[model samples]
Target chain A: MRLAAVLLFLATISAICHTDGYIEQVTQQIHLLRPRSGAAGYRLKDVDCLSWRLAVETNNVRNWKLVPEECEQYVGHYMLGKQYRKDCEIVAHSAIEYAKSLTLVGDGKDIWIFDIDETTLSNLPYYARSDVQFGALPYNDTKFNEWVAEGAAPPVPGSLRLYQTLLPLGFKIVFLTGTAERFKDIRISNLKAAGYYTWEQLILKGEADQGTSALVYKSKKRTELVDSGYRILGNLGDQWSDILGDNSGNRTFKVPDPMYYIS
Target chain B: MRLAAVLLFLATISAICHTDGYIEQVTQQIHLLRPRSGAAGYRLKDVDCLSWRLAVETNNVRNWKLVPEECEQYVGHYMLGKQYRKDCEIVAHSAIEYAKSLTLVGDGKDIWIFDIDETTLSNLPYYARSDVQFGALPYNDTKFNEWVAEGAAPPVPGSLRLYQTLLPLGFKIVFLTGTAERFKDIRISNLKAAGYYTWEQLILKGEADQGTSALVYKSKKRTELVDSGYRILGNLGDQWSDILGDNSGNRTFKVPDPMYYIS
Candidate 1:
């Protein structure tokens, strides 16, 4: 919504390609998500960030190492802007509608799988930092982990709403993530702080799963959940990897995340 | 690109919805695809059509009866505009990249499955007609069938490119459509008319599949192919039903189609 609006108003959008100097400027202007005062709204075309995002959401674009350098500003605005939240709300709306439609067993074993990052929590604070370039730069494991250590990421928009609704419907929430086990305590506090207080399990990638792809790692974890007699009634994630593998729930809902791809 | 722009230029877009009178107006303006002369471009938001479309593409929204009435123009602009073509191009790019990455056996049994409507053919001409409302109104099977009987649908943008590239890469092509078998001859003439001169199999829904869900019907057809010794290397479609069923290839690509939803 308003996010792409600022982009439309900006005349300098065509110069958005990444360069050291440009990246430096981009990092300094995390505030650029806002439009300049009195700028006329007019969308200019480049690589069509709208199309790029749709491609990413549909998994048509895979393993993209970085956002197209030219779409950095577009992605930044989108992630930080109104459209992202509205998109999340729509997803939550759909998920809730579908969840309500099911005649569930209502047993304790009926579980809902939720991916932690970008799905349950927003790392926007860290991603918008001067060094991070909103994921336009290559990922730094150390830097991201430091952000994880802070345990302060907010809940993703609309996610807590979905969670609150699902809980009353008797879904045992399973928090699944690719984050390493060492960060477990911090993640618990972060989830609580972000309004996600309890869950049946908070699964993290352990030593044995360290080298596996998110798809493989998640699939194995979901298999184990099913083995323990939990029926995966619904699964929701921002990454394709979260929803593509074995036992991907009775239905899967994909939350929008154009900032980074995980698979 | 230009499609949404014209929408931005018009001041009447917010009035779009499913009233009988509104439907009449909508139908009369099949040519509403054209933007009127000399107006300021300003995207006014209602129900956040962009978010709605994203939800549909990600399969978060499912079994929808018709396009949301309010989003008719937004969907129309997107489908007929540069965005739709660009989205298709990106899907083709991803599919081709994945196709080339494979070490194919060079045998004709290595096959690619394609869904017909909105994947292989553009029903835009019919869908855009005065009576159809670009899918804003409820679907009319008889009208749609009459349109199909003409065998005049065009190739979805980038489909031909993907097909041509795959043919050279030693992959057998399968044109799988939910269109009934009665239209087989006409569809063949239609596909060839649309530049798809060849395919290993042109599968149309037969009596056996009359009441089957697309997921079941397609899964059965694809299983038959695999049983016949074909390797489904890739599958592409505009519907989740086309790609979500059993034995759905090693990889899948979803082409964007906002006009209709097939469960």
Candidate 2:
């Protein structure tokens, strides 16, 4: 009975934790690693949402307009859930190990590319809003950009940790994003406020490249980067589009994101 | 008390089900869809194994020789668990949807590719053995080949369904496996026995490709298929090497396999 009581308390806290993960994340600067003190009650029976996420992560399902309507709560719970953080942590762990494995050239041409939105910062706070419905609701660029303009997005703990770790490892960082050039100021502030201090380049989508598909625009930018003599040693993103195109670095790591599909 | 008793009974059966999943799989010819008749208890605290699997599934971790020793039970439970089937089901769902959307050519040139082990045919019965340790043990070729020679593998229900679905949808089926040509006859018997009745081509690795890596060997084979005028519309595999590199199909579906990895 005591065990059940404790589990109930933990389950209650666990439920509340993921729902408000970003609040604690932004205000508290916590990593969202663990929700409570004990093993909480959760089941793998929510296989539908789990399946949707797996398909999204592996790029088997693309251009999904909205998450399955039935999976709104599941997606919310997952986005705010412990597993998402763990998935991101494993990716960070892999990136750190890979970054450490290389012998850096003294010339500082070795670079690591990071996709900005879900890779460097989490938009969970915005995505969890009543209007957003964890992306089951229609996407409004205006609403999203307003959230971006507010500069309240928190650093994705795993990615921020990777960013910090890469600084001392002799890999120059590049922040690549699909966010347009107009929001560059706000994005920079958001990044800095969220702990990203510097980068060799912050390439946002400029007007000149407007209307280009993410795959093509990103591919061209990467090609230009490679032609400029910077060797991309590692690339990290939440989208397959970030890591799939040419000049895709030596190795690519995908941080989990199921809130929305960009391509 | 009645609910608790029912739960306990279900739990017992669930435990027995996954441990002996392959036995039932091979003997019953039933899709391992649901494990039993109730809501079985499982906690998601096995985060490490879950994370390792996500990393593997997303191709973040590659070239792993064996499952992490700590994750043996977790991997076993996952591979034999309901989620594995559900994951594969989602992939198949996506493949079916994608295949339906495409306009197939009437020339018999439109084809779908399938990989053998852990893709079209499941090696779970062998991988779940005491010697295999659910892939925690170092791979033994002689032992694995012995299992393959028995010609007793089951079809991955999702892939088999996709194979069947594709055939009537006007898509030719092409089996492209890394298994050596010497085992071709056994593989054919295994495929036929497992419900894959006919295929446009069954390509096994020949002596000329013995020294090649899985990626290079598979790329060369796919190039040959393409050069011969086949347009690969869909390709399904359990390994990243199966769907990446030159001449990768128009779309690829990765079925869940955490037991072993091939680069």
Count of backbone clashes, every candidate in sequence: 2, 0
For candidate 2, lDDT tens digit of each residue in A183-250?
88988999999999999999998878775666678889999999999999999998888899898999
Best-matching candidate per lDDT: 1
Which parts of model 1 have CA positions greater than 4 angstroms off? A1-46, B1-46
True contacts kept of 2: 0.79
Docking band of candidate 1: medium
Which residue pairs collide in model 1, if any?
A1-A83, B1-B82
**For all the predictions, what are the DockQ values?**
0.66, 0.60
- Complex DockQ, candidate 2: 0.60
Q: For candidate 1, what is the lDDT?
A: 0.78
- Model 1 lDDT tens row, B43-109: 2235688888888889887756556646777887887788889989878877887888788887689
CA lDDT scores, all candidates in order: 0.78, 0.77
Model 2's alpha-carbon lDDT is 0.77
Query: Ten consecutive residues with minimal summed lDDT in candidate 1 chain B?
Result: B26-35
